[model samples]
Target: MEIETTGIPGCYVLQARLLRDRRGSFIKTFHTPRFEELGLRTDWREEYFSASAKGVVRGMHFQLPPVDHAKMVFCLTGEVLDVVVDLRRGSPAFGTALGFTLSAENGRGLYLPTGCAHGFVSKAEDSGMYYKVTSVHAPEQDAGIAWDSIAFDWPVSDPELSDRDRRHPRFADFETPFVFDAAKAAQ
Candidate 1:
């Protein structure tokens, strides 16, 4: 697999090899040693998959500190416009938004560090998104910024959203608890 850094510190685009045969295709999204070599988190405590229809937007979410985690998200089927925003106050890229197109055909995954928020919009029908996170879901710690608060240009203006997502605080109103550690980020 090939790992490429993004504009946000500690975030990466992991390109895994895709092998195809006469009948089907195969992909290995994770390898302990490879992730170790790249200094990426391999201790995934929880995994989840979300299926969404085209034009569905699900995000701008993250957990608060104490349960904040590094997450790796990829498209298991179909495609999505994955988006991330840096929330660490001291980081140079704080409040910066970056978008990536993750798809089954592309064999790519987005790796986000602890101080980032993530969300994605389904670009194709019956899209499935897989996630491997360093920490388990913590309901009390669950948090998010309003999706529209950022400068990202989402594909749909009136995309569908859940009531919870609709209630998230706007970016400017959020008091972030995450702190950017330059030393840890360098690794």
Candidate 2:
């Protein structure tokens, strides 16, 4: 696996090696030791997959403290416009956004730090997205910025969204608690 940092300090774009042959292809999406060597949080507590139809938007979401999370995501069976935003206060990239394509064909994945918000718009019908999360789901701690509040130009205008996602706080109203500590990050 290959990892590269994104504009957001702790966010990363990882590409897994895909070995192709006459039969098909093989790729190992996650290897604990490599993640450990990279200093990434690999203590995943739960894993889940979601299948979304085109034009569906799932987030700009993260959990609040005491249950904050780090995630590694992959577009497994199709394509999506994956986006992440830095919400950590005092970070150089705070409020900045990064958008990119994650497709099964490319074998690309994203690593989101505890304070970053993540969401995706399916570009292909029946897109399958898989996640390895460091924290368990906590309904009471679920939090996020509104999908439309940031300057990101999502490809879809009439996006399908859940009620919870639709009701999240807008960027201007969000009170973010995470901070970037270089010392801690280096460890």
Candidate 3:
């Protein structure tokens, strides 16, 4: 796998090696040694998969400090326009947003460190997104910036969103609890 950095500190785009043949294709999403070598988190505490129809938007989500986590996500079935926003105060990329097209066809995934918010817009029917996170879900700590508050240009203007997502605070109005650490930024 090859890991490329994103605009956000500690965020990465993981390009997994895909081996294809007449039978099918194989993708290795995680390899401990390689991750350890790159200082990426390998201790995943939870895994999840979400299936969404086209025009669905889910995102700008993150957990507050004390329960925040690092996440690795990939598209398993269809395609999505994945976006991440830096929420760590004092970081060079704070408040900046980055977009990546993740799909089964491209074998690309994203690695977002604790102080980032994540979200996506489904680009095809039955899009499946898989995630590995370093912490268990903490509902009380679950928080997010409003989907329409960031700098991303989502494809659909009236995309469907969950009530919880729709009620999130706007980015500019929310006070971030995360503080950027230069040491962790190297990871």
In the order shown, the candidates' Cα RMSDs to the true structure are 1.1, 1.4, 0.9
* Backbone-clash count (model 2): 0
**lDDT string, candidate 2, 1-187, tens digits:** 9998788887889999988889877878899999889998878999999999999999989998989899989998889999998888888888998998998889999988888899999999889999988899999998988888887988988899999899998998998988877654411
Against the reference, the lDDT scores of all candidates come to 0.92, 0.89, 0.93
Best by lDDT: 3
- The per-candidate count of clashes, in order, stands at 0, 0, 0
What tens-digit string does per-residue lDDT give for candidate 1 at 1-187? 9999899999999999999889888999999999899988888999999999999999999998799999999898999999999999999999999999999999999889998999999999989999999888999999999999998888889989999999999999999998898776622
- Candidate 1, residue 148: the lDDT equals 93
TM-score versus the correct structure, for each prediction: 0.98, 0.95, 0.98
Which TM-score value belongs to model 2?
0.95
Give the lDDT of residue 174 in candidate 3.
90
Candidate 3 residues 71-116, lDDT tens each? 9999999999999999999999999999899998999999999989
Measured by C-alpha RMSD in angstroms, how accurate is candidate 2?
1.4
